[model samples]
Target: MMRYMMSLLAALMLWALPAIAQNSGPLRIEITEGVIEPMPYAVPDFVGESATATEMGRNLSRVIASDLSGTGLFREIPAQAHISRITSFESPVQYADWRAVKAQALITGAVSVDGSGRLVVKFRIYDVFAGQELGNGLQFVGTQDGWRRIAHKVADQVYARITGEGGYFDSRVVYVAESGPKDQRAKRLAIMDYDGANVQYLTDSSSLVLAPRFSPSGDRVLYTSYETGFPRIYVLDVASVGRRVLPTMDGTMSFAPRFAPDGRTVVYSLTQGGNTDLYRMDIGSGASTRLTNAPSIETAPSYSPDGRQIVFESDRSGTPQLYIMAAGGGEARRISFGQGRYGTPVWSPRGDLIAFTKQSKGRFHIGVMRTDGSEERLLTASFLDEGPTWAPNGRVIMFTRETQGAQGQARLYSVDISGRNLKQVQTNGGASDPSWGPLQN
Candidate 1:
């Protein structure tokens, strides 16, 4: 009878332990088909360790929340609904308090200013139900003026940990900044953070600039500047704001430049004798190599992520279409055969898709397709949408959407690869040809 009772107690204990674990266990979220609710998260104001850090602590917490919630994968639980307050970053998280508010994730942070006037921000993310930290806590040190960047960095780590994908929050974008009316618009080159925060102009409006492309490292920019009476390619240093024109013949116009993954080689188009052909140039030696000899207008050359192939727009088949060829210049294969004229083919960083601008039936679209010209999908269609740029993750695309009629204004718009979350990027004035840079290291 004693042995039987012991056996029953052991069985009951085993079942009880699993039941307890189930209620306070890590929540694994798998994103899939339709209408899935966002994971609820809570972020209390960061603890300010010193008098100077009071405002910064509050601001940093707000920015971090905004960054994570903006992705649509995580939802912020309103502070009013939070049942518990975090008074110290080093204190043990009260999982029961978070669970009371039905929060799956909790974020805690502390901010302080060191003796050198540099700001230090440290944070940790917790799996509330699991009653454990997600991974490891992180700390960032930077100037007080760059607190926003530190906040973005913390959000990036948390996002990558939960989603199992790289983060794009710590990146920048270079674009054509325009002012005045569309007819006589004055354009210059400008760059800003991915969130449109630190706006800085790289060039003056004394000349027209177009199609600014970032180097693979994001430290340099390549753009077409008509500073010398015609369209010419110029390379600009992001740090120094200094620029120099790429070598070209006196009468030949070179435009549509793109950086290879190697960062030293450039492939662009040169128009001579009314024939536009693709050419590759080495930045150091100014050595030019012709990649395409066809009579077609081959421009907007983009290299594959592996630097093995190139995808560009060409009119070789009588209509503007997309074609892929060896990076070293060889026989080409047409990849676009839909009911539209395609141009501005940008190879995604992941090399899984190529984004392009399509025009058909008096309408324009921003679309993506596989490498072998299969599984074509259009994400957006409007009056004059053009120039599709990919996010670092390749899960989102940004493009230019122009309004219709005489009031046709150009603006930067972004959408997910699934054809959802269409959003307009706010700038000081008109903006176009937005190029996204890689994530900051």
Candidate 2:
């Protein structure tokens, strides 16, 4: 009897945790499915104690402002419009000066370098209209080489304090970098910061690679390669760039690999005997399990945040559509009933929506729908827009967009879930098949 009571109590606590975790403060920004006006904010250059620190401070402030304003949720007021200049970290904010410029929120920061050359960053967020600090000030310590990362951390905290949601600035994206003409393009695996900075190539353009998926912990990547004359799955460590092909049956081919939420297993499409189906693999033992035995092709499996269920694209009903099934794969249910053919479905990290690429009439689109296939909304339409990947916070999506022409090239683009702030992601060369990783620790 005591054990039963304890179990019930624990279940109740788990149900109540999400409500308790939400912020119910005066400075919170409530986000709904409708259009929202961007919040106006200001970020002055941070104060620094020395010459090198000053340079770091200026760049850090610029990057932080860019990170916040790029979201389309917050608008940055130019430094020239500010009436007050922050000269010290210990000084109090001039709320009246900020309010004069109609800045609803203000961010102030400072940078310092220690004797060991470690960079110290400190920041605070203020509710200018309320005339109070939104949250407690925080500090981060890192090396000079990681100044941009430190800037992202500061911006994330400021965003969280004002918006009452998790921030996604401190994250990275793994993608396939492309070059040359459209027909004879060269593809390679590359990783970069979320805003298309700090690009590092994992594999050269000597071989073709596609559909790079980040591990749950962001330490590894799974992708399909055609180096062995046929498509196969390979896992690469993000830190060392070391890679190894996952073993399969002597004649079978595997592709479209995605990691299960547990990170120890992978779900992918396998082809054998002219039949394509989904399969799960235990990476530790290299053992394989057939998840689907249907005659139709099943591919692009993505695990839910809890790992209990999987969402994938299938062609069982004569046309490509979206389906959901148990993680262990027994029975499945169709979730999409729309005018268009859907494929490449990816489950959002928040688990509230599933993003997919759709084809209708004569155009391609990137769209999102609820788990039950309701509230389906198309976010983009392009000549060739596919492979939608959600940001860490699930508020934005990045995908590949290719222009229409013989000389067309593929580039990366991002858009808000509401279909606002559509812009191109700057890369040194053509980029596509972006996989957004989790935020850094």
Candidate 3:
């Protein structure tokens, strides 16, 4: 009896090990010639069950198409090119019609207005070549006023199923919105949808705000505000927009604040007298722990995903460079040995690479490297490109890019980790210092 029980236990352990390993598998992207070509697909206008649902059906289809096509990983075959039309969502797909147009995938959906006046969307995706549905059909229900959000959900689902990486469509970005002249720039904290829609101002332009960083949970944002006469760290709840300054002593300044993965602590720079050092503080108890006692400047600390290590920028080596150290703080090893200075090193969500801003010669660039600083590759170069924030999947990065000269301006841009698909993030006006929040639940 004992031998039989032991054999059963060993079999169960073997099965569980493979399941755990599958969960951490590499992201799904079929790379070819450095980057994968956009997959060809078709998404016909959805069928509407009610009069009120007609417009939503059309608009939702457009939104989903735009979201997928904009990534440069998927191409949408125009309606005119489609050989067969989808009049009913439940009808079987004519795979041969899609194949005639060289479409590899097809999407069909339906929209309806429930008795409760809520919007309901149902959709399915198919591998046209294989002539079968990729997964079970799904539905999303939400208020009519939230149609756009519901559209985002539909897009997110399609993106996730096609790419193995989680979708970032249902996310937000917090940044400093600038207006007025470059010299008298009016910087204010602002939040907007990941696509740059639904802009909302979080703070007035009365004081300057900079370097907004989102907490791991995406509910709180940490930024350095100059409202109190000197640079001070302030935490604001994204949902409520309520804020309070972090505790600090007189005649000192704190900046470059970042939240730990656990969300209970923060790491930032404290400048006392003329010297700057790195310190960690517990948000709840207000207790402080000094991470670096160096006389040189040490700032811009970012935590690893597991909360075991931190990557930050330091000038201890005489020039600004990237460094990594134990999360509790100790001897730091320099990770950058490039031609110029590097700063604002942010650890990727996958914990396998570090993204940073490098200043080489007269040009500024946004780049990434392995955690050990090998295989460094610059993604973008301009007169001034700095402050890179990674996407939720860590496959893309958003950063601030400023033009040169008297009429210079700052804008937000994104680039894939493979150094392709450089895109300008549309905004109301000039913007900078963007912090990307996680995908919404």
Candidate 4:
């Protein structure tokens, strides 16, 4: 249980001793090279300023702790091992007490609900051995109904402050929520928080849907639907659930749609004359342009962060491999030279790396490589893994995994870019084809 965490004085000193020597300087952890060990921290139940906020504070703190510990970069010192109780928001810190319990970092907060029903949360991060707070305390206010989002926002702040990187907690994911037997599976377009909470179905399981991708702003989704008895591209408003099909060449099948950096443009695969190729479309004008005229299959187009170039999967080389081309489309350069076939290449938000699904030998894997296809690293391997989606911060990936057997099912799983912190994302039932949306404002 506590083995993942370091011993009392050693753990606290490892993180805080340097800041103490600097006389209460800022504290940060570097994650680029990967963290070999988890940092031990403590988040006590937040103090409630109002009668109605007592339980909300407790739940809020728990969610924050879960978010941090889930990264496998931080370990929360259990409340049962807490030596000091934080009963007030402004109380002075007992640094020695926290250090005694092996806590290097301490998070303290307060929650209040106003008469108008607005939820208010304020929090502070402290370096225990330094006996000082890391940064200025911050406050977040929102409607009471959005309390869960508020918790995520607090966790994001804490994560950014401690790790010196952007956080992905305050975001949403759109996926295909599946049910029924494998042969006659029913799939619906569903959206939920990044943590798998507040699930709301956008479309009933009446029509088969596949490969849902979020718009640049996350206000709309582009997906392939078989409602018309053929694969067609449809754009759906996430809030109102209104949808309309994008006009394409008659008798051509369209699928694997993704948005460019500009929300108005879309890139997808269009199959005509039994030849599948990539095309770019302007949703507002209903006009389209052929980007690829190849005789082979080209699909799963993803744009660079600047929208200048596109990375996709094609088999022009006689094998399913990853390629990069200009956003307008031209001769593509092969970037994948590794074993097995690679597909579903998604560029990271930071414009640094691309995540893809690889099928090698008898196993499937979710892996990442540089934009130029160097330094390939496989993060996960299983019976079947495909459709990798990048988190908003580009530090993690969520993908679909299916087990083998007659009763096998597909579920969502996420892994850190460093190949650590592999875990399943809890959903109501079976889920797949996850498209992680941008973090909320």
Per-residue CA lDDT of candidate 2, range 117-210, in tens? Answer: 9999998888787788887889999999999999999988987776666799999999999998888999999999999889999999888999
| Residue-level lDDT tens digits of model 4 in 1-441 | 122222212311221232211323455563222125777899998899877798889999999999999887788999999989999999899999999998888999999987788999999999776678988999999998898999999999988887767899999999999999999999999999999999999999999999999998999999999999999999999988999999998899999999999999999999998999999999999899999998999999999999999999999999999999999888899999999999999999989889999999999999999898998989899999999999998888999999998899999999888677799999999999999999988
In order, the Cα lDDT scores of the candidates are 0.85, 0.88, 0.85, 0.89
Worst ten-residue run, lDDT, model 1?
11-20
Superior candidate under lDDT, 2 versus 4 = 4
**Higher-ranked by lDDT: 3 or 4:** 4
Which stretches in model 2 have alpha-carbon errors above 4 Å? 1-25, 32-35
Report the error of model 3 at residue 354, Å: 0.6
Candidates 1 and 2, the one with greater lDDT: 2
lDDT of 1 by residue, 104-206 (tens): 8898999999889999999998988778899889999999999988988988888887665677788899999888877988998889887778999999999
Query: Per-residue lDDT for 269 in model 4?
Result: 96
Model 1 spans with C-alpha error above 4 angstroms: 1-28
**TM-score of each prediction:** 0.92, 0.94, 0.92, 0.94
lDDT of 1 at 20: 18
lDDT of 3 by residue, 27-71 (tens): 223322222446778999888987778788989999889888877
* Residue-level lDDT for 281 in candidate 3: 96
**C-alpha lDDT of residue 52 in model 1:** 68
Give the C-alpha lDDT of model 1. Answer: 0.85
Alpha carbon lDDT at 106, candidate 4 = 96
